[model samples]
Target: MPYRHTIGSRTYRFDDLKTLLARASPLRSGDVLAGVAAATYEERVAAQFALAEVPLRAFLNEALVPYEEDEVTRLIIDMHDATAFASVSHFTVGQLRDWLLSEAADAEALQALAPGLTPEMVAAVSKLMRNQELIGVARRCEVVTRFRNTLGLRGRLATRLQPNHPTDDPRGIAASLVDGLLYGSGDAVIGINPATDNPKAVSNLLHMLDAVREQYAIPTQTCVLCHVTTALQLIEQKTPVDLTFQSIAGTEAANASFGISLSVLQEAWEATLALNRGTVGQDVMYFETGQGSALSANAHHGLDQQTCEARAYAVARRFRPLLVNSVVGFIGPEYLYDGKQIIRAALEDHFCGKVLGLPMGVDVCYTNHAEADQDDMDTLLTLLGVAGCNFIMGIPGADDIMLNYQSTSFHDALYVRQVLGLRPAPEFEAWLQQQGIFDEHGLLPASTSSQLLKQLPPALR
Candidate 1:
């Protein structure tokens, strides 16, 4: 049945739950490109007005993507914690929003409420929220995961030391890795986006990272972002794999386009676990998601991009991933046209992921073609800091040479840490102190007297 709302003499109707969601979403070029956006501003407001009245229970009853057609939908439906949801079962989407921002929805309550919520419900409430509302609610939702180090603890922000090399050169990667570590980054993980998927190349890069990690005893995880199948093959070959990495999407079909399924992910998760790599904790999966992946793959099944992005979190939560980051602006101008859009999407993605009980992070980034720059990144980085985001990318200088996009850098991480008084993961923080990179207060030591630079090998320097 269609849902309708009225303003004066005008009545707006949404054909279905999916249509309602699409029309309710904050305007984005991707939604417009999908031809699912509200035709007019008035219609968008009407949709939001109508959506606010939707009963939270209605999402449970109505399937946005048919149950028979999508495994992701099945996973979401079958795994929902109805008992946890009973607290807010009677509330409308708008009421839920009010409750979320209310003093009653503290950290403990939000944590307990996570498993009960569905991606659709979370996405719907998000559509009704302003950016600050998104941040405030997300701040209260603390999601901690462990793998070599604890993450998502309040008063801390982690950094993924992304030492991506265009040619998979070990020395070049090592230089960048050392640079990031010296800057007090890499507490989250030392993840690499390799230029080649060649099993040999992937194995070599993993070994290089492992060698350095072992040599320095860096208290963090490392990942070579390759296909799950390649990771499985490497695992079978006894290659050192710290975190099994994959780029996931919201829909089963979109994941299928990436040659992955829920089963494949389970296989990879199990394979990585059997290695017993982590010393601090066993949570050992890393996932990267973005707003427009499903739509870009032509497998969105008519849902809006942000909702699709939230659905990917459903998948991430299943495996209990240590790190689930949205590469927010990496998809380019088509999905997020400018800095403002990218910032909004980043906040939304973080808020949605945290609400669903995932340790969420953002790759504060943009392609060169997009209408964004470092100033935009500075704004987003500072906001996410205040929002209590789990982590951000630490590229060499807020630029990924291999991927050819701008992301948060090692220096950028320091800037945020200094300004916001955020620290790295506890384990990595101790390591920084031990290495004389950071003083007792977790601030970097003076460059002249710093031992961190001296620790770097002559070749790396």
Candidate 2:
């Protein structure tokens, strides 16, 4: 079947639901690179108009990637809760958008609607929304989860203190970890993207982070972003694994490229839960995703990148992760192209993830070679803060020497916290106050004494 819409004197026809969605999407370099974007602005608008009339139920029938061919599509289809979708099932994509933006789509309503929604539905609705609309609907959907600390609470923002080292140096990693903590940045997790994936090296990093957490009694989780299989091995070795981390994609093929499958993720989730490591909650999985991953892996199956990105969220949703973030701009300019494109994709990823009920965060970053600067990051970070994002990456100085990208820094986290009046995770915030690093008002004191110093070892001090 075909979808068509007329504006003025012209009628634009989209060959299929997938083509209609691709055409309806806002302009992005990745879509263009994949040869899926609309040929002209008018065609794009026409597709949006046609898409607006699409019934929500249509997505249930039209599998962009056939159910027989893709496990992700199967997961999406088999796991959908029709009862949860009843509220908006009869509405067109446009009507769904209207309902989401209306006053009735409160936090409670959105949560109830999450299980019923497929990732494609949310992605379709997102295409019809502007940045502000995206922000508005997302802020209303509060998806909280926990491991060592509570995250996604209203008026609270968390940071993943990425103390990445160029050579997996324990000393260098420790210095950056202490620095991030002193700057009040590790409420989400003190995560490291290690330079080496050696099982022993990764296990050592995990133990080192555990030792620091034990020594200082920090109220947070720790993750060494390595392969799921590596974490599984570490778990068998009795390593301190607070969270099992993986970079997941939206499709089975894309996930296979990362050496993961739904079964593999299920195994990791079960293995991590067996440790009973969390003091607060058992959501121990941490996932990172990005746009264009499926296309990059040659696994997109002709779907647009944004839709593929949303499908990845379905994978994350299956696990009930402690943290699920889109490293939006880290894929470099080939996908997002420039600051404007990066900003748009970040908002879209955050919005789609939140609506589908994930504890979503963003790595607000760009490559050095990309057409973006710190100012672009500042704009995105501030906007995400305003939109009530669950967490962000907190590098040392907005630069990841190891990852070679410019992400938001520890200071950047503080700036957003100060400007937006957001606080860290409650448990971590109390710990900060207890250490005298943060005062009663949650502001850093003008003067520092040996109080905080006493909490650290001599080397860190």
TM-score of each: 0.98, 0.98
* lDDT, candidate 2, 274-305, per-residue tens: 99999989999999999999999999888899
Looking at model 2, report the run of 10 residues with the lowest lDDT sum. Answer: 449-458
**lDDT of all predictions, in order shown?**
0.92, 0.92
Clashing pairs in 2: none
- Residue range 217-274, candidate 1, lDDT tens digits: 8889899999999999999999999999999998999999999999999999999999
Off-target runs (Cα >4 Å) in candidate 1 are 445-461
Superposition-based RMSD of candidate 1 using all C-alpha atoms, in angstroms: 1.4
Error of 1 at 189 (Å): 0.5
Candidate 1's TM-score reads: 0.98
Clashes of each: 0, 0
